[model samples]
Target: MNRGRQIGISVSAAVLSGLLVYGVYLLQLRQIRLTETAEVVVPRQFVPAGTALEREMLTTLRLPSGAVTAEMITEMSEAAGLEASAPLGGGEPLLRWKLDKFRLLPRRGEATFQVPRDYVKSVSSGIRAGDRAIVYLSADGLASRRLFDEPVIVAAVKTAANQEIDNPKSSNLLSMAEGDKERMYASRRDANGSIDAVNLNLTEAQWLALDNACKDGAAKLVIAYDAASFGGEGETGS
Candidate 1:
């Protein structure tokens, strides 16, 4: 073929290829716009862990139906009165996993008590709100004995400075699994070590037991990740 014919053929091929690519792009854009959407609950402001979800704390957001996951909180009622299991940023979708376990609220004669700063610090970093832990009592500062016959669920982990030890640099101890060490280190840091208190969901009888233990001696809280790990004293199972 002549050079002119060759050049014309190449130009035609280039134009056709461009049109095909542009056509595919438009098709994708159209499909995205056609996707279904659903109203979902998301945080309107920063929601701290252990805080009860209030109406003002959340708002509805219309999101693509495909983006919804099984863990997401679809209804406002499901999130209402539920405590956050972890810190949630503003505009973040509310998820069931982010909230503490749904349990009956404190009843008459029952109260939410704050665990002492020292006691909170003593517990492993793996412990969080909704975890079951056993409280121990130390009479002479020499040893601690288990005070509770069974574990009680940790209602909330509160800090005096409103911050958990979440920064890696702030953590001085390392006992978590290799997979969790990096995350545990990333916990919020407190320069004053003011990650102070933890709330315990205790019944009247349990509260009285703790009070009696405190009166008799110092109380130390321990979280056992496994029941079999509690064979020895002073050994905490993370």
Candidate 2:
């Protein structure tokens, strides 16, 4: 080959070698990140013991996998509003065992209200704790009156026998296979009972309105405004 042609071939070979090395570097970097590192939720600031963690106070951090075990908190939702069992340093990964698990009951200054079984005449079956819904009172099953001026947060959902689902008192059966989970849930629901009671946190005025409405209303229906992932809340595609 001519000198110019040989130089052109050498240039092409050099470019190919450079691309191969760069690709190998990228692959190694990815492998290192995937195997050696873990994403976990950590406190953005030094949090004292018994301090409630909020979304603003927590952040996602990538730390070594050995530093974050399977029992470590990795989601913001898991640590949000939970009290720390021990003091945590800034940027330290939160251990799941070091957080207190509290029931989703009413906070201070809020009263509790249980949804009567008769109130769930045409209600959504998938309502759980932390869901906000508008409770309506219907006289003839046609016209309905608003029970409260706003949606109320559900504190707990109980079966007819009063078994709590969200705040499990060590129901290990729920952690099994997906089929077992369905069966366990279905067993809670399969008595043909829609919902025995749904505990709600309400103010005095809101409680009075609901109490008075229940006395006069012939039927009731709860329509959930917020969406839970498992339910068919999408009547409209909006």
Candidate 3:
């Protein structure tokens, strides 16, 4: 009789262990499902570069969590009123880098000047707006030093070919068919032409100094981006 009791006790213990394991397995499955899906912000229509985002232009979707990147914006409020840095298509996830605030052209007691294309290319192609760059003055392109003691912020980077594409004047043009716009951008991006120029946001004194340098043809503009100072990463020079 004792042997039978012991056997019954073992059987009960095994069944309870099995039930606990199964419950844990079910919880694991639920956790996986929840983690695999997320709500992300997506464009409702073609969003062109430099166009400010509005609530109507965006919508949310339940996307696979694995498919979303860190750069993908999750909220419409985060994107609204910001400009698109690049073109995004319908149903595409809006990325953080594809938007900008335009910031401002010039502040009080400040001015802006356009740096020649050759000068902008000297530093590298990654030059972006809001970057602080040191302008080098040299009669020829070689052997130069800083033009000013203070650094200057880049207001804009304009490629001759991409100007019209980025700054579309008409609202309809902004919403143009994706294919047509893609073709247009492809042609512009591929064309052999003058590519990049930097618009320097400067103080009146700084502008005068740069202007004099350019007019005399005694110095050429050579830009060196202060990578550490770009986009609130470090101190911005006035």
Candidate 4:
């Protein structure tokens, strides 16, 4: 009788331990269910100028907690019906898509111009987000320095009407014909119309040259292609 009682007690303890282990496993399973994977929405198209995109137009997508990675963008673009390899516009397109992906946030800031409009004419107006520009500054009152020959990364043409040329829709200064250019020059020379204030992304040296030229009252601008020239040392022929 004593042996049987000891055996019964051992069996009861083992069963209780098994039950506790099973309960803990069930709790973990429930926790995982509570944190199920969810989908998010991303942009599919490059919204062009004059097109209105609403917050509701974005398509929702699903991504697991550990699934977001660098390559996931390509996958997301494919799933969102957008060409994963398509090139995006320089500033606005990149910004809009990045915002859609929740990768980058958007913020507004003023583009300030160091030169006044009476000096440069709104030549910066025609520039777009992706267009290239050659910033020129009068060099010693004889020629002009090509401060920058790179493409315009972000154009503030929209602001051309305002103090900073904020409006992107304004016509570019380089697009003017000879006649138009003459008229613009005449107006600026007369000082009766607005000054030629333009904004550009330039290096520190270029900025310094522009400022100096403006102060010296001999600054001018010209639009041209960017070129690189290499020269070798030469000697006088006999």
Candidate 5:
């Protein structure tokens, strides 16, 4: 019985020693420095707020995993074409929150398109994101045609500060003002919400249709809100 106990103990020690050796081998094979590094997408240059990121603006860097954060962008593809929600420094690791995705990448069959403010004529009612937009296009600067057969979904409405408008409690802040800082900021947010850039989710065909019309340098877009609790007054005419 004593001999058996000794043998069992020796076997257990040998297994543990083998496991430790194997673990060490794995660590050596993986190379701690290489295994500890994570690939993160970073800005190549200082990017201003509201600027749309292009492929040229981004680069990948191998940073220590310990330095990587949950919010840091890992894929360069993920950062391209996204609107910078805030200013980015040169060579700084790009964080996800710095880019607003609410107006980017839509459903599988649809694409999100942002209308430049320069193509707009006037905005009448207040607009917010998540509402559908009734779009019209004037290609000849004389005649206006419906841009889409249906009211497309507005993906996002960004303020001049490049901040995407969130679902606030209400846009009509005057009647409900509590005279607090939150109220003031809310009112300001609604005021600055968006009269300029409106992102819309459009079908691929619809996008091509808009593109074809605008190719002549004659097209301008106008947006009207469908009758709903959400409303905004914006016109599309070049």
Candidate 6:
């Protein structure tokens, strides 16, 4: 009888131990479920392709921790991201916490060119998309020459042909007033054709300067770089 009682107690203890272990596992799972993490989907504009997910980048992304929702993620762009975060009334801790919230992926932005149409047509006629241009803006005229005197280099074209010039077309002299066409023909008669305006990408300051200069008079477009990457100032005029 005593032996049977001892066996029963041992069985009961084993069952109790198993129950305790199961309970501990369930508690651990609950804790895990309650724990939070940050998740975000940054917009294409805010995040550039191949941008390193460094702490500096993170400082820009303000995110809250724990089971982050989609709304919360969208807000993340507005939160810690550069533009949004800039105005947000927050401290460093909030900024740092937000940075710790997300990851970055590949994205692209449009490369826009603001070249004059005439230049675009001129360069497009002679140059292919990937061609380089030694872009020259018209310098102010001196007493001896017309206000549109010499061309000055403003910027070097950085993008490939596919990305550089946009919507190139030839200017029609026939469409001009009879007198205007005659004058244009006479001026261009010494040249290959009428000089067309072209578009170019430049910094904010460069754009402002170029705009002011062009407003004063016509700007010249010369094909400085070609297939063989040849020709500029020293070469015979194209």
Which structure among the candidates has the greatest TM-score?
Answer: 2
Each candidate's TM vs. the true structure? 0.39, 0.44, 0.39, 0.35, 0.42, 0.33
Tens-digit lDDT string for candidate 5 (8-40): 999999999999999999989768766688899
Order of quality (TM-score): 2, 5, 3, 1, 4, 6
lDDT of 4 by residue, 44-99 (tens): 54543322234433455555645545533333343332222233332212222333
Model 6, TM vs. native = 0.33
Candidate 3 TM-score over all chains jointly: 0.39
lDDT of 4: 0.40
RMSD of candidates 1 onward, in order: 10.5, 12.2, 14.5, 17.4, 12.4, 15.7
Question: Of 2 and 3, which scores higher on lDDT?
Answer: 2
Instruction: Write the residue-wise lDDT of candidate 3 on 1-238 in tens digits.
Output: 9999999999999999999999999999888976897888988988766455789878998887777789988988888877676778988888877776553345435667776554332653444455557777767665766789977766766666555223233221222223254443343334343436568778878877777777656566667656454333332222
**Stretch of 10 with least lDDT, candidate 5:** 229-238
**TM-score between model 4 and native:** 0.35
Using TM-score as the yardstick, the better of models 1 and 4 is 1
For model 3, the superposed segments whose C-alpha errors exceed 4 Å read 1-103, 116-123, 140-143, 162-194, 230-238
Error of 3 at 46 (Å): 38
Decide which is better by lDDT, 5 or 6. Answer: 5
Question: In model 2, which runs have C-alpha deviations exceeding 4 angstroms?
Answer: 1-54, 59-70, 74-93, 97-103, 107-111, 116-133, 140-153, 159-194, 203-205, 215-238
Worst 10 residues of 2 by lDDT: 229-238
What C-alpha lDDT values do all the predictions have?
0.61, 0.65, 0.64, 0.40, 0.67, 0.38
